[model samples]
Target: MKDAKLSNVFAYQNITHKDVFLSQKKYLSLFLNTIMNLESLKQLFLYHGCDKIYVKILSANDNSKNQVYLSGSYDVLNIFPISEIVADSSGDWKKERFKASVKFSWITDEGKITDAPNSQFILYPKYPEVRFSGFLQKSHNAPSELMSKRLPGRLLFMSVSNSGKILGYVSSPESEVTQSFNSLKHLEVAGVFKVLELELKINYRELLLKELFRIHSLGWITSKRLHKSGNILPCVSSNCGGYTLEAELGISANGYSEPDYLGYEIKQFKANSFDRIANEVITLMTPEPTGGIYVDKGVGNFIKSYGYEDKSGKEDRLNIGGIHKSGVRQPLTGLTLQLIGFDTETFKIRNASGSISLIDGNGNEASSWSFTSLIKHWNKKHNQACYVPSKSVKVPLQKYLYGNKVLLGNGTDFQLFLKQMLLGNIYYDPGIKMEFVSSSKPVIKRRSQFRIKSGNLTNLYKQSEIVDLLKI
Candidate 1:
């Protein structure tokens, strides 16, 4: 039974009758499929027009269970460059920012052309659970229905030089499909889309290269696609479909100042067609410990993984914040507040909300009140002048004033919270240093942080008063 199971893993279905003296072997096929260097990429680039091209293979994975699987994606992204690449935005001196809508084209080995779309790109670390089958067992074989319906996709990246003279390409597994019911489920789901398939019906490589050529002709520097990597072998056992070859590659960014540049790593595999009665596509995957090759279903338990949740089309809550005067009924200015986690406990706010309200002890009902209303209420009740104290005063009012005069998003969130005052838009007309103070003060006398010829508030005297009042 064990030998029979082992035979299934390495089974090779015959395409045509041929007599061979040697017995079936799996390792022989795998050894022939693997490509360990970057020479191929360099060759592809030179073939197009590049004077010189650098190529490096980082890592790779391969698996076989009656079919082959390979996948790949590109490394181009609109990101903040390592050395700030700046451009004059119609007299606006904006810092380095990402530009959208860069397009590219690709050409295939057989002269086919294809279009490459543009969008955001991100590189993530690979997990360790990818597995592969060493040998197969009939009892362990995937169900016939599931095996018949599988369709796996391969991935690759092909690039051309900036001069439009050279082309480069790398291919690996993007992902795969497995199980008849599950595969059907994917097709049945409405509003769902499946990419163009490259398999039995089509000469996968020829189609892939043709698309690459299409992208190249369209002026795209490169094209990326998925493909299975392995050669077919003769069938050795009964009830065999054909030889299935699998290959996986691990690509990692080179440790350059630019974190975006990555090098490719490739692995190749070859196994008999009849090793197992599995389908063309292997959907569910299990990681093998040896390297990157992953095993499809017909194994054991599956685990859930966590990642970004889909919150598309969800409404966002309306929240606002700003600086408020001590006694003013109306807010001087207001801006929307962006929320972020501070510590595990409470939220640390860098700016005060423009509006204030008194809430019940239970934190339910809120009675709206403004700074001017509060001051009027206080003055009416006390019949004495109510002042929002400066830092010079040793009282709760002074603490409140200190906390209110804050400059946020100036280097760091915590720094703004600790330092109450902020100098706004230094590039524009140097304005007054906004500070927390009591009401009834003339706006013209507001102290200016940047020196300018103007009103008292903008004058040196008011500026001195502001510095003295804030104790800064």
Candidate 2:
């Protein structure tokens, strides 16, 4: 047997030390008596290689028999990215299955983490919520006492790692974790998640604001970006404002969809003044088409079919740029934007195959974004987004000065994005063009943007806060 580890630990990885494994009862006792507060629980999750720790307060309706209801809405998808869902034929009911490579475990008081191989996260698109099944099957030291009965208020914690694997822990109904859950339930994080933030004795909001103030103190900064190799490079593009902000924050974009800094997505947009922070159009997303002639035939062919000559009279160049709003026909492309299989009255998706499509005069789908495809990029990036306005000057070189008045938005839902699309607040404005058209292999730049004006920015989030750095 390995050396016996301590029953109580205040550090992050004290519970992770290899020790003589105790029985399930002793582990339960340790878990109940030890300092297993929310912060320590988060530390334990960190020790087990998880960055995104999502804890849910289990209700009476949430049980092993009930398949452990995750959420009633698309809130689950916002935190943890659930991949594309395909029809499941082996099931008795009409259901869909997706790729969830989660390896779950039940951590014991004996400092033992046992794996549950049969656990699965199921998604019912018809109800639009995710449920967990096959849990508690063939697992050692599993929490059968609370899970077997109809017990509410039990806390279920799922910790997702950088590799997309999930480690799970369920707290007893009468434990310290439960007590923390009840007291901190009022301060749950954005979406269906219930998190108790005792880290550094500073809440996430304060931490984010503190960092922003530090960044603002530095007046005009040179346009530069952080390389993945831990180096800084001179940035000279229209996107230099955002790139400079990220570089100042020391955020090296290694091609991950994680937040910019301190769990907040930093959005720096160009503006004339600080008062008109959201006056300019903000690009919500720029995902390529999942289906239609844009994907089936080719980008080149799609540009040739729908693209028009450059209005500036540039030779051998074709461009497709215009505002394509809901149910409106774009004159340049002659394509009308349509929403398929969505109930506008109910503001819900009636069909999983629904799409935000651009249709040609002949009713052919010129470009399309399926509901599943859009869900892949929606809400996963910015649950808590910080919008900073900046003014650029290009006299000697391009330099930007960030504004003191900043807007912070929290709690985004995919359906809310769709609702904005239906309300004509969100529209597709593509800057797709083909240069060197006379050459054998022409150069194509496809920028399919779904943008919204600054005035209507509050419609996308559940909460919005404007903070002035000059005061704080």
Candidate 1 lDDT, tens digit per residue, 277-382?
A: 1121211111121111101221110010101112342222111112222222222222111121111123222112111321222432122322222211221121
* Among all candidates shown, the one with the greatest lDDT: 2
Candidate 1 displacement at residue 402 in angstroms: 41
Query: What is the per-residue lDDT of model 2 for residues 1-472, given as tens digits with 9 covering 90 to 100?
Result: 0011112221223333343223233444545576666655665555544545677778887778887877776666656655344434343334434333236677654446787777766656556677877668898887877777788878888766544556677887788877866776366564466664422222457656766788788989999998977789999988898889888777765545656665677888788988876668888778889889999999899999999999999999999899999999999999888888666887766666678999999999998998766665566776778888888998799999988888888877777888899999999999999999989989999899999887787888888988898887
Cα-based lDDT at residue 212, candidate 1: 25
Please report the candidate that would top TM-score against the real structure: 2
Model 2, position 5: C-alpha lDDT score? 11
* True-structure RMSD, every candidate: 32.4, 6.6
Which 10 successive residues of model 1 have the least lDDT summed?
298-307
lDDT of 1 at 325: 24
Positional deviation of 375 in candidate 1, in angstroms? Answer: 45
TM-score of each: 0.18, 0.81
